[model samples]
Target chain A: MKKSLFIAAVAAALLMSGCSQKKPEVDMTKQETTETTAPAATEVDTGVNSVVGTEESAGEITTLPEDERMAKIKELEASAKKIYFDFDKYNIRPDQEPRVDEDAQLFASDAAKDLTIKIEGNCDEWGTDEYNYALGLRRAKTVRDALAIKGIEESRMVMVSYGESNPVCTEHTRECWAKNRRVEFELLP
Target chain B: MRFFLILFMGVALFASDATLEIVKSTDNRPSVAIQDASEFGNIRIRQKFFRLVMGDLKVTAHFKVDDRYRESDYDAMIDPLLKDKDYLFRYRFREDGEQRLYLDAKVLDLSSGSPVFERSYRVANRARYPFLIHRAVIDFNDYLQMPSVEWMRRYVVFSQYGKPKSADIIVADYTLTYRKKIISGGLNIFPKWADKNQRGIYYTKLGNRPVLYYYNIYTGEERRVITSDGMLVCSDVSRDGKKLLLTMAPDGQPDIYRYDIETGKRERLTFYSGIDVSAQFTGSERKIVFVSDRLGYPNIFVKRVGDRAVQQLVYHGKNNNACSVHGKYVIYTSRESDNAFSSNTFNLYLVSTESDYIRRLTASGINQFPKFSPDGESVIYIKHYASQSALGIIRLNYNEGFLFPLKGHKIQSIDW
Candidate 1:
């Protein structure tokens, strides 16, 4: 009886090994699902709003027809000048502080009182992706803190760092790279 | 009785020599030549597979791979041209309709004129054919009793920018030959494999709040992990897949944080006023190695999980911005230029955490995201030079390197 049991265990182990040799069914099933879903995902992507304003902006922006408010926000955003930064430096440059002051005034105006401000920070295509992102955030934070000091409510502002991915200029020249490292403001009503 | 004898020999061989034995016959490396034995298939795909297999064998650095393509019978006598080679690799490729692919491969000993290794691989999707080649080469190397080349079979996940405000996350084989877009649409960067099995990944969707998400590759399920203001990234995962090292900037200050996936609890690891990001788990998950600008410039630093003290890890570079850890070693990319704008060189360097040993791994170009293979025997990184991007692989034991160019798009970040 002991010998017979030993033989049966060895046979079962061999069968298990043979079954393991075949590729797992999970991969095939997953591959088919990805193939069918990837194109649908791409079709539904629909630019930047697919990720960001999906939840909050739905009930507010779609229902409202305030053309005057929209025009006011657009004008405020256009009037808010871009704040520049030095090569790897995130501190407000001496020359760029005036731009920040102008932005602060535009954001603090009566026309923009009911709106929230989004500070979009950008950088040149240098440094590691993670580091550039952090640096960009610092630039945005500096601008946010400066605006807050100028009486813009801290809770009404949001910051997003594009990190070298959203470069305005794709040139490899020094002048063009300098043009890419700046922060722009967007007003959301 | 036979099984006991085999087990005893295996244990004795491993216990006698703890160090890996890199395959070398006497003082010279073995030579290998490949022959195509496909009965019928797409001509373009066959040629591509031949080139890819040759590249894989050459990158192993354990064999002198013949570059010349030749067609011959899979089981016939070796040709006169390949008579001097040590081994002959034969493969048969077949495709059904459009998607399914099958590969049957054999390795024959030149002197003995007999089959030494044989295996077959198939994939349901034709776009994933590169993995078949990777697996075949890895299996052939293992049959020769050489050092493990199993890292060749891993999937490299990366994010690439498409437009100004658009990026897509993709998964590819180690060679970047087979690519599948896993995540598309708005600003999806910083992809990290959430588990060792490659079943799920964690990435941040750059939006107003910059939400971090965990995506299951098989089930097409995405679970919201967390969200933060300013910046958020899932940098590394623990060996057990229960904890994640994340870089989150809730108050506009990027700091490293350790998050427990099971409990949804977070523990801030760094309290630096300056930039701190890209934290990687090192030495028992009790410690982490990350990048920080607390010393006036970006450099690599390490800190314990519960300790308040931080220690500088790499003292050689001023702009050591990115790092990856394996065992007792850490590999990082250091900027080698005074000017941060325009084009500059970023090279990779290796340093031991326990000793003062340091080694420069790359000579030139922009090298970043140096990821060590699971076995710690190799590293795969991104290399951008002369307006082209390539996937760089380094064999640490052999001190050899290879580059496989990726056309068209630029790779933002990569993890295997």
Candidate 2:
């Protein structure tokens, strides 16, 4: 009985915030009924609110409903972070071809046409600075070339090389080094 | 007259006390022996610590590391000699952690069999253990009768990785101890100290727009100096800090250019259509040593200011990527093998400016970014191992080598 009262309070607070658009009234009504039947209803609502808060803070989310366009953009951003490279090499790995294809498809889609994507190429700290810088440029160019080949215009995509400047992990192990050498994509309006 | 003589005697006694005379000269390097204490749990850890200390001393080229002592023989040899003569230096590791290390060392005068200097050095937990050892070595050297070079205690500038597309400029001791991030928030690379004072560093920050940025090490103030369309990297700064030698590719081909910091005027130094980069100033501001591919292969070239005539300094290697200049000596990296995949053994070579005398300083591994010590007797370069990278120091006169493996991540570029 107490859990039901807590769920109703949270549901009321979320509706009163008036921050989230698109069916807040409907979600509040659904929560009012589910709060009585399910014990996990409050937990689910909290998770949804946290995700919504993150998107709202990023300021990239628009008033679009949950549709295929937004889904494709998220899928592409996930694929963008999946860039892989060969061992001790900065060139794009052959195994990452499918992910590159997926990224290219997202860039060509109508929703992503106006978005600016910045691809940052990086390398393992195994070589000299000048060599790594050149190698990083090659990696970024390879991805940019893939996008161009897939019908994405060149103007929408920009490429830069961080060389070996940024490493996600500070460990000296091989696994960390492999992860260090990659290309990441950031989307901008 | 008698009272004046007494006063003169008093003055003479004080003057004699102020002067120190070395009655004996030892031609040999200072001998040091290290043994693991039984109380320390692991013998391997003790041995590793001893090796690190010995390596640090050997690289300084001032101490003669004696490996004649062992942990098992400590009871029979070191214990008896602990009170005897000829024990120049002694060290032992007490505590070890993932980031912190404790070391206790003692120095003795062999002739008198008396302890001269003793101290315990501790460093924060850092990935580079050899650096902690290096600091201990520096202290040991300073405690000795003579210290070789004072610059051993200076901070080393290099890049460390935090993420796949993120590397920050870091300042650390020669042994990579006491590391602090000086530049981050973007991809920062090729960190070079703007001057010997170590007040500022210039590095390339690769973001949406690639630009060369200058960062004050103390205040954390950063300013964008210049922006380029394709590539931009600051190779070296003049000793006086008035000019910077940069490799920029604003017109599509990378070339060397001289930029005056005071006037904001950039003069194209090299008009080559091919790649001409990595320009380092000689002792005098009139000449520069840079790497160029005008001969269809990357090699070191030297040219005087206001002179169109360029002289090739190195003709032995195919891909001599980087170089540093000190006085008349030029140390450069040369590719030893032609096979692309087979780890092209890159070694360092030292050559004279006036003659064709080329001396190989390093024989194996991928060594690059060779910088001369302020005294010009030593050269510090980056040594690439199969798994890690190290800051290697070579004493030219002593023919001794020392290396401090970098902890944290791989080092991109370093300047003393």
Candidate 3:
């Protein structure tokens, strides 16, 4: 009886939520139903939503009309230095902290403050996908946290970890791996 | 379902035109010749079976498979006393009136002209012809008494990067000839088998955070397991399947944690502020092996479950990271040099926990993620070099390796 009631509540919530909405939750009953059906549902839902929210913000960068976004990408390209981390380390190298500061101040400006910036974290080819991802995200988060400290609103920034999937250098040299281990900034409309 | 129907139809249509090049045997291995004389229900059906048999023998590394026999060699093969060959293997394929396929295989003593070992398998589904070779190889291994190739029959679950910033987890045979994409359409990565039976897998999905999800392939049921703020992965599942070794960064520094799957209780395993990820159970599940940057570079490390003591496992490579364990044997990918150019040469090495004996598995190119076949006789890994990405298999005792290119997908991780 309870399972059927929960299922009905979920179906009703799905009907009410429509295709896309701004609210994170549909109904209180829906939460109970989701939890009853999936004990781990709430956490993952929060996770998915947080990513979706960040992506939605990231998508806003692309929405600034094509002309504006392309112009912005061109303008930001010179300012956005790919933040490099020491091998297996995400701590913003003492000398490179200024790069984060300069970019953060520019993104915080009134002209681009509302726009979303995607910080893509990457690793060298050495680590596994699982660890590289963690390392990559930590690197992105380090950049994100530094931007936040530099007064760029946290919501204005998005973190994406490509791990070692996307490599800037195809070579096998330590210099190439060092180049691959970086956080790249991308403007999303 | 619709996508699979199209993919399988495409594969079957393409199967006739595609043929894997037969691998030559490495040095000092026994030269075994598999003679072809199988009569099945259909010519096409028999040819497919023959192809799978060749693939099986080529993968096993125990025999130096000699398939390029001359016309004289074929005439010599029929005598069951083929000279200059260490062993002569023969097979006969028959179809019963009920459409059931039967495979009768025998290994002959070349000089004595006697069937030293024999096995027969009959199955109803000839359409699923891959199983015939799987059984044939297992039986062949049983006869040879080498490390059982039965692990080949199991599934290898992995995540591959798809286009446009998305990834999907897939289940395929060890050779990757048979593939079934279980998860797709979003960013799903790091799939680890949840149990010994390979029925379900634990993977992470990105959202506001990375969340661990447990999915059963057969039942189409997915359960949420755990979630973390920065990163999350079920690196290893305990032998009993009751506990999971997870890497999570709730406090901003990624560390290892033990999550009791049943009780929902979590215990911190490593408190290092640096990075500690890729934890796998070793030494009877009481100890753990992981990759840590606590020493300023990613290297393999070991620690007991409840103990605080940490031990470095590899001394040769400064950047030894990805690894798999079967008993005391550990196969890991280690970077040979810190030079910027050698970054693509992440080679695989085999080491034992109790001893300092380490063996190099690959000589060149970028080889990483060495997963020990469940039988521990061979290691399967991802090899990336130039514009190509491949799945590599290395036979331990033979010092031989084989590479099969993945045409489109770039591999991420794998669990056997």
Candidate 4:
């Protein structure tokens, strides 16, 4: 059983590397600032595994006949944390860095060695669609770079911006807006 | 006849910007009144038809339209009350079957007591009655040899936000009386007409990867154009529909890119580290005008194609975030208040690329997404005030404005 899981893991890694090789390469060294030439890719399909609706309850994961590794992956995703930001700002607050660090540690663990991470950035409904989308992207990018610094492979991550369209809270309050301006984590296979 | 001949000649002499100056100086618009001659139809719908026609005339800024309702036969003598007006407009409306509508309209010169023009219009769907009126109005405006109010005949496409993670792209007439859903069932936004004919549209669907889709309206065919990791929005289509100005963030940073439809090649236009988006082709496609946050807040900037040089277009506001251009004039939305958390009074301003001359088009409310009509004589923008959203139009030549309130829904963006 251990041998089979090891072979599966290695094959997944090789497949991910093969897919990433087809994408236009981004020079990490040159991306330290703005005005760099961006790579144009026709499509970027990260992966198709979503653990959102897998387990109805935390207690149910232990009884499933799935691989122990898949069970552990579900457990990790169930505890995935969200990091919030200030109004009209994308910079991850100093207080939220700890959550980012914790999330980064889970993705780095052996249980999630072959899974992809999808980072979703959202914003409060306060700005124009074009500006809000860009801001949301900035928020997601900041989180992605932070995770990269914390040892998460860049090729295993994908980012998407929901702009002001996906709000968790509909109330018109400052606290609700703050809750809406957040970066969420999703695990993909 | 003599008066209209002189007016038509005046319109020819002064086409666009100069026409506004001439109208302001002369203030000599012909007076016209609309009379409902519908023998049978829904009373409310008949009233709506009259109001829409009057609205179309007023929007033209080429006539003084009477607001009071008057009824007369299509071939009857002009009403005495309408005699004071230079022209008496009459229309007959009826429903045949299954909501089929027919309209026979005529404009009579009250001074001469003879018909100046007459035409019959029909629509298979009663819900689409507004277009028939719009077409008639455009025809009348053309008959007078006035500058084309052709923009009125074009459909206004927009996206209305629903539940979280849900928005639907809708196309409607200028008055918003005619609306049909084009795209739905996900967070789809930024619906832009793909060409001058508006046969297709470009919109973005948000998901694990932001995908931009080009949908043809007539055939209901959809083709996925491109997908980006961070964000992707088709901001503007080139005048010829062969190239597109796209806001795509490949490295998690947003910038403007020009994409060619034929070659599938995208050339990065703006390479700022900060946000650069909402680009519109300007100066006959020689340059592009876009909104960028180079100064830590959104402002308008213009860059020549194939050149790395950039120039700031508007120096008036800190948050001049959205803009649309036609010929030499650019219309943009500027935030007047500093509050970013709540609704701010964002007004529209018109500026000329030829000189430093500036004109304020809107005075109050959260006015954004200012799109210049194809003719550049009018502007249509989204307005939010007092928790209510409305579609607003400004007849630039006449300095007159009109609002058509959208009830129970929030407008995400709009374009023509």
lDDT of 4 by residue, B156-183 (tens): 8999899987899998998787999988
Ranking by lDDT: 1, 4, 3, 2
Q: What is the interface RMSD of each candidate, in Å?
A: 1.5, 3.8, 2.9, 1.5
True contacts kept of each: 0.83, 0.20, 0.41, 0.81
Off-target runs (Cα >4 Å) in candidate 3 are A1-98, A110-119, A124-126, A152-160, A166-180, A184-189, B1-31, B38-52, B58-64, B69-77, B80-86, B92-129, B144-147, B340-344, B385-390, B397-406
Tell me how far the alpha carbon of residue B321 in candidate 2 is from the true structure, in angstroms, after superposition: 1.2
Q: Against the true two-chain complex, what DockQ does each candidate achieve?
A: 0.47, 0.16, 0.24, 0.47
lDDT of 4 by residue, A8-37 (tens): 876786687567656544534335454466
Best-matching candidate per lDDT: 1
- For residues B7-62, write the lDDT of model 2, one tens digit per residue: 99986653332112223445576566555443343767666666666666677777
**What tens-digit string does per-residue lDDT give for candidate 2 at A27-48?**
7788788877653323334435
Query: Which scores better on lDDT, 1 or 3?
Result: 1
The parts of candidate 2 lying over 4 Å away from their true place are A1-127, A131-189, B1-27, B35-49, B68-78, B81-85, B91-105, B118-136, B139-147, B385-389, B406-408
Off by over 4 Å in 1: A1-65, B1-27, B40-44, B97-99, B340-344
Q: Against the hidden true structure, what lDDT does model 4 obtain?
A: 0.84
- Please tell me which model should have the higher lDDT, number 1 or number 2: 1
lDDT of each: 0.85, 0.71, 0.76, 0.84
As for candidate 4, its clashing pairs are none
Q: Is the docking of candidate 4 incorrect, acceptable, medium or high quality?
A: acceptable
User: Distance from true position, residue B1, model 1, in Å?
Assistant: 40
Task: Tell me how far the alpha carbon of residue B200 in candidate 1 is from the true structure, in angstroms, after superposition.
Answer: 0.7
